[model samples]
Target: MSKFFTYLALGLLWLLHWLPLPAFVAIGRGLGWLLFWLAAPRRKVVRINLKLCFPHLSEAERERLAKDHFAMVARSFLERSILWFAPEARIRRLVRFKNQERFDALVGQPVILLAPHFVGLDWGGARIAMSYDCASMYAHQKNPILDKWLLHGRTRFGDQQLLSRQDGVRGIARALKAHRPFYYLPDMDYGPRDSIFVPFFGVQTATISGLPRLATLGRATVLPVVTRALPNGAGYEVEFGEPWTDYPTDDLEADTRRMNAEIERWVLTMPEQYYWVHKRFKTRPPGEPRIY
Candidate 1:
């Protein structure tokens, strides 16, 4: 039954990939409206996250943000079809790179494309994979059929070497030495291990201390990669921020804290595009009540 439904969804997505961008996003937003209601558990998760992170917002405002976020999440999910099935010229036209000079300045050097968990991450990843032979980590999907589909979508464009958690940091380090830009997204609660509680939106969030370590090990400069889904269904805009000057200084936790701070700044620009449905604060500090 699950396989049947997965195939059904995939078939629909494959067909819908041919639609124009505006129509594609309109359908995705409709799906988002349905998901906002149908996906009760995730809706609750988004609510809690918004409440925790944006305490300043009124309840009504937060509620609207949650709905908009669900729409973006749906669009982000459905839009992968464009990356997977669309032609190279089509994708290149869709994802526009802003301030490529920042990345271009550090050409021939090991670089880490630190992409935060925005709704448009896959879109951004596909864009980067077009030009650079990148190395990135991916989680195994439970269903083999869906996993295979995801793998194909990610690797279709460039020489992308996707590593699972089991591959360890060593694999990425080697890839960096090989000069493949690491399309790293290290923003999530991966339990208490190797994660230090850092201030994310004033909450002591358990963030992995891997970004600094990877930059140090790989000798890679960090460039913040932000992919924004343009309003009115224009297209995606991927902006690469200026490279950090003195990153990964003597302090490890401090470096991780700074990383979280950077992500907060980016999220402020487009809160709805951030990954609100994720249980980001699932593993709270010791003796603290569970968030999800």
Candidate 2:
């Protein structure tokens, strides 16, 4: 039954991919409107996250932002078929890189492409993998058939490698040592095991400290990467910022805070594009209440 549903969904995505850009955008917005009204659980999560992050905004303002966010999220989901299964030339034309030289300079060095969870994140990864062999970690899906398809779609370009989260950091470290850049998405709540309570939008959020540790282990440089979905189906822009001069400092907690601060800055630039549907503050510190 699960396999049947998965195939049906995949078939729809394949058909959607054939639509023109404007038609795709229109359909995605319609779907997002439906979801905003129908998906109560996810809408509540987004509302909670926005309220926690932006206390200054009035209730009505936050609600407006939440609606816009839902629209972008739906658009990202529908457009992913292009990234996953579209022709190489089509994907190439759709994703543009802002600072290609900065990324090109890290050819032989251990590097981490620190990408936050923006709506166009997967598109950013696909754009990078078009030219470089990068490594990234992915959570396994329960459905085996879906998992295999995801793994194949993400790594089909540039001989990229996708490591399972269960494989531990050793695979990523090895890939880094072999001079492949790590496409590290380090902005999620993975519990409080190796995470420390840090100030994210003035909230004590549990953020993973593995980023600094991984960089230290691989002796890699950290470069911030951001992707923006252009308006009117103009395509995506993947911008690679300058490498951090002094990162992974002696203070792991401080380093994690700095990482969160950077993500906050980016989120402010485009609040709608940031991944707000996630329960980021789910893992609270001891003696504290859950935000979600």
Candidate 3:
């Protein structure tokens, strides 16, 4: 049954992939409009997230932002077919990199590409893998068929290694030490273990401390990378920032806080593009009420 559904979904994606970029953009927006109304639970989640993060915004402003966010999320979903199945040349043309030399200098060196949960994140990862042998971890989808397809799509270019989350830190560290940059997605809520409550948008958010630990273990430099979805189906731009100078300091908690703070800065630049539909504040501190 799972395989049947997975294939059915993939067939729809393949058909959508054949549409012109602009046409699909319109279709994706229409899908988002439907989802915003139909997926009431998810819409509520997005609303709560935006309210928590941007308290200064009026209710109307937050709602507008939520609507835009849903549109971007939907576009990213519909565009996955292009990222996963389109010709390599088409994918390359659709993604542009800024300050790529910063990334180029890190090749063959132990590095951690710290990517946040932005809408265009996969495009950034795909762009990086086009030139570098990188490693990253992924959570397995419930459907085995979809999981297999995702793994294949991500690793089809270059010598990319996508480890399962169950593979643990040791696996990722080993890959990084082997000179494969870890395309680390460090901004999700994965519970309290190995995580500390840090100030994210002034909220005590649970953030993972593994980033600094992994950097220390691999003796790697940490570089921040951000990808933005250009307006009007223009394309995506992946920007690689300078490597952190004094990261992974003696204070692990402080390092984790810094990580969250940096992500907050980026989110401020484009609030709608950040992954707000997620229950980021899902795991609350002891005795605190649930935000969701």
Top lDDT model: 1
> Which parts of model 2 are misplaced by more than 4 Å?
none
Per-prediction TM-score? 0.98, 0.97, 0.97
Q: RMSD to native for every prediction?
A: 1.0, 1.1, 1.1
What lDDT would candidate 2 get against the real structure? Answer: 0.90
What overall lDDT goes with each candidate model?
Answer: 0.91, 0.90, 0.89
Q: Which 10-residue window in model 3 sums to the lowest lDDT?
A: 16-25
Better of 1 and 2 by lDDT: 1
Candidate 1 vs 3: which has more lDDT = 1
lDDT of 2 at 265: 92
TM-score of 1: 0.98
CA error at residue 142 for candidate 1, angstroms:
1.6
- Please, what are the lDDT tens digits per residue for candidate 1 over residues 1-292? 3999999989988997898888867877898999999999999999999999999999999999999998888888888888888999998998899999998887788999999999999889898888877889989999998999999999998789998899889899888999888888999989899899999999999999999999999888999999999988899999999899899898998999999999999999999999999999998898999888
Tell me the deviation in Å of residue 289 in model 2: 1.2
